[model samples]
Target: METSSGKKGVWAKIISFDLGATGSKKVKFYRQLFGFHSTRRRGTQTRRVFTPGILSKIPHLVLGKSVVAVPPEACSQLLDFLSNPQWKPIQVHVVDGLLSAEQVRRAVEEFFSRPVRLTGGEVPLSQAVRAVSRRDAGDPDRRFVERLLDQLGRFEWLKEAVRRAKEELSR
Candidate 1:
């Protein structure tokens, strides 16, 4: 329950980015409830990047977590930065989405309410839980990739980021 200002807790934010044939849509909510929501249009989409910092909207504990959603390159960068051993212990959580930057943000929030399992090797990443089917625990659990792909597909920011990353890597 943390806010951008670093005064309140129970903060909540929701971003829904729609990046499809039409364009991209983004919405942001803060403070446990719907406080801030905005949509920015662009000719092209870009992959969204969320660098959770101490004063980030998300709680401080959420940082340093080895998130499965984190791209490999970003993860590598994170590792290099925090590898000094002076960094704190973080628990990264990975979830699936619509491939929208806004959706990515939503995935992060939804992850809190839903149950997650350990997936990463070292710092146990989080995976969104799935419910049982009619038989019992028969239903296959929902994977993080699903949500992530879904969100990413529509997220203009996310797409753009991916494009940039690919271009940079190509060089």
Candidate 2:
């Protein structure tokens, strides 16, 4: 999928996988690994909710898809999986937009790990400027903001605004 700029479209889809019957070992393991909590609703129906800090390690199971969505809290586990050389080139899409695309991309690049293309939208220019303005010089996100500014500088329509944002951030 390509947009007007010829960049491949970033698409996201939500899929449900049944881990077997309720209370089974497969179901229990999936719940524990994904940090899913069960709560009873009206009648006997139960709902599963995802919580953070539950995944300690990547499961031995292999995902057939080339892209997988993981929770933000499992960053460590995700990193471990990416660091492993045995797996194929799979792109990781953080399930919730808890982390920015630039942040994830920077982290993956810094670690020299596998390439991970984040799903969803990029940070807006105004938001990027605001973030850079709010952060201190030592902030890690400063580089991302700088890169965004440089890219925006090439567009004639955004050049002036990008220049102003950079000038403000410098002060």
Candidate 3:
């Protein structure tokens, strides 16, 4: 059945890539609130890339009736993208690294003007990894490896690695 907005399902489009502190919260928000469980299919990664190369794709994929929860780091870039005259109008909300249920509900309501009930709970790191991994078979070890690869490619990790490498070389 379609919602009054003509959109099907309750899942929100979240553009979070990492499973770290902030990323974890966004993933949990998508899962618990929107029931957006990542399918166990290869190449089902979230279209969260914010580069100019994929900007058009991201807007096409997510700019619709579903509420989009953007990570704080992507907020500025996403805002800039939305500001482009060529881009269509879209609703967005930037979530902090952590939040309470009340905060989440308020943010959603403010962005979409619809009341939403959010459950508050912690998803274990291992389980979150398994949930977000693209492996067809549910293997804990493989999920962990996939999660590590995902984390390592994040901007924050790259920045830290470069910083540490520079320090070690200087010393």
Best prediction by TM-score: 2
Query: Candidate 2 on 1-71: residue-level lDDT in tens?
Result: 35565554222222223332334654444455444434547788664432422332221112333333333
Q: Mark the regions of model 2 whose C-alpha exceeds 4 Å error after superposition.
A: 1-123
Model 2: which ten-residue window has the lowest total lDDT? 111-120
TM agreement with the true structure for every prediction: 0.20, 0.28, 0.24
Candidate 3 lDDT, tens digit per residue, 73-131? 44566556444443323344543333333444444323222111212222332343334
What is the alpha-carbon lDDT for the whole of candidate 1?
A: 0.30
Q: Which stretches of model 1 miss by more than 4 angstroms?
A: 1-68, 88-157, 160-171
In angstroms, how far off is 133's CA in candidate 1?
48
Q: Which candidate is the best by lDDT?
A: 2
